[model samples]
Target: MNNILTLAAIYRQSLFYFAIRAMTILEPQTKLSRNWHQKAIAYQLMQCFLGLCRRLIINQPPKTLKTHLVSISYVAWLLMHDPSLRIAIICYDEALASTQLRKIRQLLRSKWYMALAPATRIRKDKDTETLFETTAGGEVRALSVQGGITGHGFDVIIIDDPQKASLAHSETERRHLEELYASAIANRWRNPAKGVLIVVMQRLHVDDFTAYLLRLRKDTVHLNIPAVAPVDMTFHLDDDEVYRFREGELLEPERLSDVVLEELRTAQGEVHFQAQYMQAPVKTGGCPINPAWFRTYTELPKYDYRIISIDPAFTENGGDFSAALVCDVVGDDVYLVHGEQVQCDYPNLLRWIETLDKTWKPDLFLIEAIGAGKGIWGLLRERDFHHVGTIETHNGLPKLRRMEIVSPMIEAGRVFVPANAEWARQFLRLIGSFPYGPSDDWPDALSQLLIRLRDACMRAGQHRCRRFPPDPPPQQTSLRYGMHYRKYWL
Candidate 1:
């Protein structure tokens, strides 16, 4: 073991070696596991910590040992190389900052660390928990982002989890933190050009510090490690080094295996899981349709009725998408066969609907009677589309209200989604965010489909269609209705 340590000490140029060695001594319970995600993070963090890179932003899932390696252990590694390198650590609060300070202190006390950096000794004079100094004129100060460091400057600064999760969606709090980062924290470097800054945290919102920094600092190196890899994006560590993963590859399965991650997704639900574990936080709540309530089907059941639901855009541009969902109703259950959200003019939308009708051969074409949707209904009626129907929007209620009326059918496990469809992921994202999402077209289209199914079933005396209002008769003539299909009787 001594000989191995001697060799490791000689080969301490690699940050991975340094991190594992430090962890081995300081955190004995942590077994040495060679996770690729950790290795990539350590390398990039070391580059920034060593002043090779000016800034680095790492957005990874929580409990991935992010704070342990990047914030706590790396500071000790820096001291080993240059004991006089001044460092400052900032977190959401002073208590959290002190926790990291204690971890660093523990590492510095390890016998292994003593052998690695024999010249570095704690300055007996300033050896407090939150603020400490080494004999070589260097110091590590731990403070919160709001904690004033008026006269202090650091050679390397680490902002670890600066934004608290509780205040993630508060606009005022988020903006205030951004202001402090720009004015107070960003400028407090001893040497501006040579100083290093590292940000490590899970994504809590779309406008969190990570997003703000990336938008402002285009040159900042970013490492976004989602729990499940979304696509084939490569992490360009350097010129010759890159880390690539398949579409659904798990980031760190050894520590967070597929089974474990699935449990997390189930426990946290889609909204929280996407933000905390998936690193794709959006500004939204539980949304209208809870993804957990969506029943998935590997194969479709026999259906007596089918409809192509449409929510048309108001214009060719600068409006919501012209969304559509092809649905099949079998008994009490409604199955979503296909779904899409696209931007197109009336002509294009007509063509797209024609293609869907040809493919699905739905019994009726159910179009929402509102805005540009009125035009769609008119065109379909004029063209004599077989089995075309115009469903009236109740009192011109908001799309949100319409969606709420049909959300319970989904929650009751009466709506089944195609398990193998490529559109499933996008559909889940849209429904998970609902009205707060960028576009409400997809969910609206879904609501239209489910409402039509339920209303039709209710008229036939089927108790399965418990929610929603009565379905209005489909308009038979284009010349009968005006621009806005107002109900005459009501």
Candidate 2:
């Protein structure tokens, strides 16, 4: 045994060679770089982005933490290059969209990004199109997502993230978002060379807009760089639980964690996730007044209403959606039961409304006598709505005053919405979108309907007008000194 003296003595003396071999298999540098333990690729991308922003004022992208930097960087990158891009980044919620904008501002203010500027350099030549003015005679500007955002003929269309707070599973919400894009965002692009649409988003659901685009823009490049990269670069894991091989496979409910899972299973679950990350075409979130509030999610008996409210927009392109809201007077409350948002030529809208009326079987039709709505109203008057017999006509009210009248009803939780995310989003966002500017069409139309209804109710002594009820029949017939007084009444 002693004579054999295993490699314990001789080989032990060459332990350094074994150590070197081990180093080859597990290198510290590789772990630090590849293991995400040190400055990983994500960090480098950040560095390059910050480097680009450090000096240019307009170049300074919004500064979000490492978590949100990816999407933020993409938007910042676009804004820095060309400021004329009038984009409607439709998201599920106003809070989230506003947050994104603020973050972009924060990135610009970061010490790292601000350093790119020359000491004596200053921004100049500022206008809507020329957003940024480099210290060396340059400028930058912005285009809002509201009414005037269109007609910019933007050279670039960056859809960093659309939709507000959303659920992936809600069908109603999904439809509303599709409407926004088809009606609003689609018209915004008039440039012949129409700038490329750059979208960066997380996977929300199967039918989410991301998936929609995956199918829609088959020719365009799709780049999805998630938080983590797994083995087999060609295929990636979706979240933690599910394996996604197909380009458009949505992250399933079981794959996500419990919190998100909870949101997934609820009535709002599908709508929320779909809009939040999956980029599902969804209505705006926080819509205190959702069209769904007027609808039945489950099969139930619906009673006929005295009138059906409809508001329509005019113009061939760059027009608001034509809306048809159905309501019945129940006691003092107006039960708005169902509605539709249509974008069609004049004839088509009239035809469709008549068809919808037949299907819904409402008692009568009440339409806004303004703009495109007047066309439908006129058409309905000429053709007769299915010869149902009843017809009521009304004009739009002051937009702001109308909203003020309805706000109380929303705050009191009296108005029921079908839980539409995009509708709610546009409803809420539009109110605050412009201090003194145009708004999302649905809200304006909705306000008009409520105002018209309230007026009708007030005249009938049914609904107490939220804003101004008629002064009680000149109660007491007050006769002031020197004032004209009727001989008998006074």
Deviation of model 1 at 152, angstroms: 1.3
TM-score for candidate 1, residues paired by index: 0.59
Q: What is the per-residue lDDT of model 2 for residues 1-490, given as tens digits with 9 covering 90 to 100?
A: 6743453343223222222222233333532111221122233233323332111101111111222433344444434443333333333444454555445445444443343211312234332221433343322223333322333443334443443322333555557656666665555544534344444445554565566665655554443433222222332112122333345332232334446444433423333333333333354333333333332223223432334666666534656677666655443455555656777777777677778776766555556554555556556656644322222332223444345445544444445544444554444455455224354565655666565555555565543433233342343222222222121110
- TM agreement with the true structure for every prediction: 0.59, 0.32
Please provide the root mean square deviation of candidate 2 (C-alpha atoms, Å): 18.8
| True lDDT of residue 331, candidate 1 | 62
- lDDT tens digits, residue span 1-490, model 1: 9997776565357666777777776678978777778778877876775567888888899988888888887888888888998899889888888988888888888777787789888888988878889999899989887675543789989989998775666667789998898789888889998889899999988788898999988899988889888888777544478878779998877778899987766545455578889899866534656787998999887875677888888557677788888877676677888898778877888898888877887667788777777878888877867367877775555666566566656665778888878798788888888878887888888877766665666565646542323443444222322222221111
> Cα RMSD to native, each candidate?
15.0, 18.8
What does the lDDT read for residue 355 in candidate 2? 81
| Residue pairs in collision within model 1 | none
Steric clashes per prediction: 0, 61
